[model samples]
Target: MDERIEISMLLDFYGSMLTDKQRDIMYLYYNEDFSLAEISEHTNTSRQAIFDIVKRCNKILIEYEDKLKLLEKFMKLTKTKELILNKLNEIDSSCDNIKISNSINEIINEINNI
Candidate 1:
């Protein structure tokens, strides 16, 4: 996974835990693609303040992830489903392997329900 994608997913997963000010700053910086100066001007704060707030919010979000692991669990579930589906496709291409492919598909469905 790319770092940008990981960070983006992390922000999405834990965004609700942030204070309003922290959420606003993070949304502006990451989702809105705003510069620090722009965030500071919009929020009427110093650029350094905006930087510090964003850093602190990131630390808090990461700490929550470290302890709770919701994002990690979600990522693992997604990756497992993808791998299973890919294997099923490979087996489907082998005409002699229909039964195995069907079983794999069933297992994939069950994992998705989890």
Candidate 2:
């Protein structure tokens, strides 16, 4: 996975563990695409302080992911769901009965919602 995307995912999974200031800074840097200088200006802090906070928050997020593996499990579950949906689609295409096709379609919708 891309580092930015992985960090974004980590932010989603473990952001609550961070201090409010840390979370807000990460959100601005990663999600809002703020530069360190921009964040420093917005927060009225030194750019070096913003940089240090971002660096520390990144370490914290990575540490949480390393220990918890929520992102890994989430990726596995997503892949499994996609595979199930693909198989269901194949089965649906092969079916001739209208009722069975409708039932399979309903199942596909439910799986998509997952």
Candidate 3:
């Protein structure tokens, strides 16, 4: 995955573990797409300070992901769900029974909501 996107995913999964300041800085830099200088100005800190906070926060997020693997598990489950949905779709399309196909569609939708 792209580095920014990967960090964003990690942040989504593990950001609550970070301090409020760390999470705010990360959200500004990554999600809001703010530059270091912009973040510095907004936060009333030095640009280098903002950079260091972002860097340290990134490390913390990566460490949490490494230790907990929540993001990894979530990705695997999501991929598996997609595969199962695909297979179910194939079955539904090929089957002659409309009721069974509808049931399969419901199953697929339920899985997707998870």
In terms of lDDT, the best-performing candidate is 2
Residues 1-114 of candidate 3 have per-residue lDDT tens digits of 899999999999998899999999999999999999999999999999999999999999899989999989999999999899899989998999989988998998899899
Ranking by lDDT: 2, 3, 1
Task: Please give the lDDT score at residue 56 for candidate 1.
Answer: 90
Q: What is the clash count for each candidate, in the order shown?
A: 0, 0, 0
Model 1: lowest-lDDT 10 consecutive positions: 1-10
Query: What C-alpha lDDT do the candidate models reach, one value each?
Result: 0.83, 0.94, 0.93
| Index of the highest-TM-score prediction | 3
The predicted structure with the larger TM-score, 1 or 2, is 2
Error of 2 at 32 (Å): 1.7
lDDT of 2: 0.94
> Ranking by TM-score, best first?
3, 2, 1
Model 1, 13-106: lDDT tens digits are 8988888888989888888889999999999999999999988987888898899898999978889878877776676677466677778677
Better of 1 and 3 by TM-score: 3
Clashing pairs in 2: none
Error of 2 at 107 (Å): 1.4
